[model samples]
Target chain A: MILNIPFSDIVFYFVAVFMVLLSIAAVSSKNVLRSAIFLIASFLGTAILYLLLKAEFMAMAQIMLYVGGVVVFIIFAILLTSHLGENKLSTPISQKFLAVFLALTLLGVMAKFLFNTKELSESITQKSPEASSLIAYGERLLSYAPNGFVLPFEIISILLFMTLVVAITIAKKDNKEEK
Target chain B: MLPSVTHPIGDFVRENVPNVLGYLPDFIQPYIPSAEIATLINIIICMVAIAVVGIAPVPVLIYMERKVCAHIQCRLGPMRLGPHGVLQLVADIAKLLFKEVYAPKGADKFLFYLAPIFVLTAPFLNLCVIPFDKNLQVADLSVAIPFILAMNGFGILSTLLGGWASNNKYSLISSLRSGAQIISYEISFAMILLLVVMLAGSASLGEITASQSGHFWDWWIFKAPVLGLLAFIMFLVSSTAELNRAPFDIAEAEQELTGGFHTEYNGMAFAMFYLAEYINLFTTSCIATVCFLGGYHAPTIGILAIDNILNFVPGIVWFLGKTFFVVWIYMMFRWTFVRPRVDQLMALEWKFLLPVNLLLLIFGVVFLAFGWILP
Candidate 1:
């Protein structure tokens, strides 16, 4: 069985295990900063999984956005807050149950999706999508034809612009108040 | 459509390096698996090459910076170590290696240990995608630009972590400053690179470098004339801030934050951060060389004899020369300029550089649209 196993499968399983461990560590850690670091590690593991799947762009985006931007921002918030990792947080039993229930439901849904999707199963058994170059990726992202992401992309850009404007306005108001 | 490298070193590894694997004794070959062994050997060779290329110059760079700063200040720097103090860094490194490594009380032990390592890895990760020469890059990933940006984010994270883990107020404040500065400047840095990508029509570093493989004027710094020059200057400014050098080095301002994020680090751990900084300096200069200057491509005048002679020199030499020239500029800035206030640093990036970057990007787009690229 070991001889029969493909090298890629071994790498995939290794990354999956690593990610699972990291996620567990993140959720179970008492120190908020430690949890955040663990979360970054999980994100990094996900990036490696993307690389294994030959989704280079997805991997880079994973690192750039989640591990790099979101987690760092979270750490900044944590550092700036009054309590710096000294909080002995305890979840109420009811809330913990609810979390578990919701988590199980989500896991079930994801598992169902994975097992029932014939296309995904077939694609996984075969070669995954060919690694597309950035040129093609950009073209598809900006193209106006069917299958193009242009409209949604533009909408997202507008949304981000609004968010930026709101953030700036709020920040400026706070500054003026302080002044 | 993976971008192809014209002179990829991978072929050399495949054709030549695997032969050495064949000499393995028959007794060991069956158990070890020759094919896997070959791949491992190839990977090791690549890693060694990357480490050598990315890290080996750090000592020399440190020495060079010291010398340049001293000369600029009209002082003799490190004259006793060796001839012209060439071995000064060697002695310094030895001292660092033997120093006590310790974490302060109340410090996060794990993070305190991990921070230097994480920070050190960022530049090496960045060096992977940089096309030093046509064949010298470790991996020419299609998402090289984004990868580099992500690595910059990684660097910032490590800095923040180092500061927080230090359990020192000065370290925290300095790291906070560093995080803010780097995150702000990163926007301009990414924008300038994006402008280059738009002109080159490819985000792959290898392809971008290949696109400029012609006359010197064809380089991105000259190709679009005013906009190109503007973009290059903006890149330099933003990258200087990114590197946290003088004028923009408000993060580790000695007058305020004692040793910055690395205040708690000692011994080789401190040296790791130091080495990472210089490596990052080299990597950024290399990026500047690849993007703005003709990467590895020799500059040529129209004179046939001169052009031929220039072309005869290898691309790696030209690549290193341009990179070091940019590095020299970075050193000059550190010594010559006065450090700005933290508020001023923020203002400079958010107010001045950001707008200029956006305008330059627009101008670059317009130039490209009108076919006004200089030949």
Candidate 2:
């Protein structure tokens, strides 16, 4: 759809700026809460870009699942150390060497793959069709035939199942606590 | 339907903007609402809006609570602060703001501060998808209820974490009880939700409200009476527990737990959590209106097709009115109601509410199969 609005471009630039600011905050905040909040800002900024591109469902899903579910879960986990973790406290375990080294190596390898991929053909960009996220998602979700949801749908479900099991096991009642 | 022009900005520069100066602005328009980007911007707007809306109710509702509580108790209550003690809430907030925010000695400091912000930002973010007035929503998505419910569930994280992070035994104790109550109640609440979704035959909030229009008795609550009544009752119980309001306010049983989970918090951080608790008050009300009360649907009339004509009044007002009513009802329970023990709260969720929600879900599926709603 042609959005003839004169200032949509201005907002897009703001979104980009917001993303960078959030990334910086996420990386640099010594306070974990602040970092998580910045992370949420990053996700929300990304979701807006998604909406601007007419991908409303993906935007909402990013907010709902990632920000709402995943981030909240992580924040709560941080709280697990709440009683004992009140200050700008540092962890005793110093794995900085392995962590920083592996991170740079991974980034380099990913960049290499992006340049060397064999399907280095022309980029494909399609304008989004107009449909509400819920409706479109349900339709795509149910379509498992010729043009199907066979792979991705199953993968999503499998991921959800694994997350469920992992969460329950980790959070399950500890036998030692019972004693 | 509108035609889309995917032409590069430089190509359209001559047609739209007469100057090269407007180049960058023209370049950025087309890629706006694609996916993550639009949602991100919309979420930020919603978060900011919530800060204003969320805080407003903190003072207003606190004063209102005092007045209401006084009436119930046959006393005039505070008449000194502002008009009829209207400024009482303002005074209270002032005191909380100036109060020394101390991380008690030996307290794990980071989680102590982190807890309040976690509890607070949630309500702001959740408010994004709600349509208060038709054009006023920051983001209108089809999966609004699920989105709302999911947020409602996630907000509990802040509550539990806030409570546990304090390291005080009282706070830890409150977190345990509150966490279990929330998780258990949510199961029943979710079941009730599936039932309503089935009955509506649509997942989008806008479509669900649209599907319920007709005469005075045409609301979905009136359409599927049993399921509606059951869902409404269960939703009420769960929301009471979810919001940690009276009868279910295990998080702050001062007599026993010394302000429950918030024992270690003070100052502005504490105030944020306090304000957020009220935002949840309004958020849950909005969710209930969207799901069971036919949202912003106007009642049908005898002579005029009132529902049809009233659709012009913007879907937001009816939504607000319905939501306010729910909020008021919940508020009455909060201020004027008697408290329930922790065990009773647990039993209510596990025994009474869960079975009702299960039954409602089953009926909803059957209703869908019978084609009671439009495909």
Candidate 3:
């Protein structure tokens, strides 16, 4: 007897497959626009999974902001940056081999780690994990751990501030060279 | 002024809904066939609530506008139609309906007509998720805000498509302005939306409204002032632009872009767009209430000891009260405020509003991590 998969499960699988395919195409495609579009597809697929996981906010974050803003910006920048020089960006076999080796090794290590740990491995088996709502997520993020993750949160803020400063300084004309 | 008159809608609702357990859908309704019919009867009534309540607002809104403008300008407004011109809108609608629709020589006949339908689709759809009473929602989809946002897009597209199809140069310019302003504001509007999503936990409109109930402090407006404040501002700016209202009303800027997008449309074809514009104002206010202010939850005036008794107040009353206050705020901001230039509008969005919105989002997340309150 054949077991019937739930509609949601089938949808989740289809999205996952589509995401993997799009991600591969994102890396391999020669057309930059095609790559950006593929990346958006991957982002959307991931967002659907996030929605299925009941992380609605994160799902939209993936879609509206990341896909809508960041990807749109990247595509626009790429368009603005000029499309004339395709040959200049082409790389050789040695760089490709090195990247392939690094990726394969990283994947192998992750696969091995998954194989080794039973408790960590079991958690990965969950298809649909019950997650917090936006409010619940908010409260838990803030109030759960006694002292809270206040230090880390503050540090992240500082890091964001420093990054902003550095980005502006770099984006501005080279001051040291000018001096 | 009456301190706190518990609204009449709740009592009206109890009379409408049979309280007996048999009136409910499960087992109790089976013995008495009439009780079984009550739930179905309520569902049918629930569906028509939009038709009954939604269209009434357009006429009432017009009357309010007239009264408000009259007061501001120091003039006596329409006193001719049934008392203080309450039926003035009804007369206006009757006149508008019979007027001959003049299509421009250059306009695509179908799309020019279709624009009105597209514009009205949003307000009609807004009626879907609005919780009139506890069980009175059309589609309590888990993702109502996004659904509403999607509906808003359709409304924006109508203007764009309408202008483009007209083949008129000024009309095209107006449409482009509408597109630019609405699309740009949507990003920041969305970031603020995410902050609300973060606060409320769930995207379901009902969940967000329910979160605000029982007490004052539990309301999201007080939960995180930053989130509420940022979302409020973004919703305000975006809704203004979305409705094509000033100073973002550059779409219909009479002096510069001529009649802007509607330069080609006339008579009944034009009236549809006009009707839609007014309806959109109400839609945005309703959205603002749900997103930033807890929709329909009463403001702090007194402590409620018997909470079970008070949930009895029809949800629609809260929905309308919050919606009206927001609409009033928007009207004040528009008319009382000086309009900015188009360049300033774009700059305000890209340079100032967007960055502030982004920072507010991060702040919201940080507030969450600090054990600000129990979720």
Candidate 4:
């Protein structure tokens, strides 16, 4: 049975296991910094999985946005708020039980959402090479046809801009009274 | 016919590189997966070639930087080692290799060791996507632009980890500054890259190079009107900031922060950061060459005789020539400009570069919409 499996299948299984282990390491590590690093490794493992799935654009985006942008910001926040070279205590039993319950609930919701998406299942079974091309992705992003995503894309950009303005406003407010 | 003449060696190598597996005995071929083995070998060979290209130029770059600095400051530099001090870098590397490798007592040992390795990996990853010649790229992903940008982010991660793990205040402060500066400048950098992508109509580096294939004026810097030149200048400034070189070297400002993020690193670990800096310089210059200059395409002056003569030279030669020229420009910038205050650095990116980059993008869109690009 193992001999009958293709090379890509073996790679997929390996990457899936790697991601799971990294996720566990990330959650269980006592050191905040180490956990952050483990989280990034897991993100990178997801990127490799995307590559194996032939979603080249998505893989790069995953690396760029998650491992590069968001995690860096989170690390910065951690560095600012916490003392360096320190580790946190392990979780208590009650806290662990609560965390497990929350995680299970989230997983259940996600699973239900995934099972209900007909197009997602269809895409999984019959992938189109052209759908993964950068040009097609760009066109779809900016298009306003029935299946287009231009509205949501523009809305997201505007929302992000608003958030930036608000953040700057709040940050600068402290400086104004002193002046 | 011209391409055939110019890339004959490249074509031959690309064609035959995959057949190394076929040369293995049939008995072994049946035991192993031939296609997978061939791919693995190809990847390994490409990785080694890229590693050599990334690392082999460090000494030359170091020598050039020293000589350039010496000349600027009116002093002799490294005159004793070999002719013109060419062997100085070799001596420096040997000394670094033999030096003691130890983490600070309070340092995060695992992260401290991993930081240099991660720092060195970024440049190699970035270099793999670059088209050194017509048929010489290692991996030509559809999202090559984003992939390169993402690899650059790794540099910041390394700096943060290295600094934080060192258990020193100066390293931590320097790393924080680096994180902020790189993050800020990255926006402008991405915007400039977006301009080139818009002009090329594709994100693939190969396609971007092909888009600029024509006369000397067809290069992206000269392809459009004022927008391209403005974009090119912004590219230089933002990339310099991204590189954390002088003028943007506030993160490692010797006057304040002792040695910056690598303050605790010694010996080979320190050498890795140093070499990675130079390698990043080369890769960024290569990117500038490919995106703004004509990539591997030789210049055509509209004179058939001169153009034909130029075409006879291989693409890699042109590629390297343009790349080194940009590298020289970077070295000149390093020696000429003074480091900016950290606040000034932030202001420069947020107030100046970002707004201008957005305006250029708008203008570029307009120009592109009206089909005003140069032929």
Ranking by TM-score: 1, 4, 2, 3
Q: What tens-digit string does per-residue lDDT give for candidate 4 at A1-179?
A: 13555676788789899999999998888888899999999999998878766677888899999978999998998788666445565677999899999999999999999999877544332476568777888899999999999999999989987775575566556557868
Ordered list by DockQ, greatest first: 1, 4, 2, 3
Candidate 4's docking class is acceptable
Q: TM-score of A-chain in each prediction?
A: 0.82, 0.61, 0.71, 0.76
Candidate 1 docking class: medium
Which wins on TM-score, candidate 2 or candidate 4? 4
* DockQ winner, 2 or 4: 4
Clash count, predicted structure 3: 11
Best of the two (2, 3) by DockQ: 2
On a 0 to 100 scale, what is the lDDT of residue A147 in model 4? 96
Over 4 Å off, model 2? A1-113, A116-132, A150-179, B1-52, B100-102, B108-110, B305-318, B335-344, B372-375
Q: List the residue pairs that clash in candidate 1.
A: none
lDDT of 1 by residue, B60-147 (tens): 7998998998999999999997799998888888899999999999999999988888987779888878887666777787788999
A72-170 per-residue lDDT for model 1 (tens digits): 899998888766777677899999999999999999999988998777544342554553546667789899999899999899988986775575556
What TM value does chain B of candidate 2 have? 0.83
**Model 3, runs deviating above 4 Å:** A1-179, B1-47, B300-313, B373-375
Error of 1 at B5 (Å): 5.6
lDDT string, candidate 4, B1-375, tens digits: 001112444444556654765787876665556555545556566778888999887878888899989998999899998998889888998999999999999889999998999998779888888898877887666788998888888998999999999989999999999999999999889989999998998888888999999888999999997778888889999999999999899889988999899999999999999999999999999999999998999999889999999999999999999998999999899888878898878878877787688788879889988989986
Winner on lDDT between 2 and 4 is 4
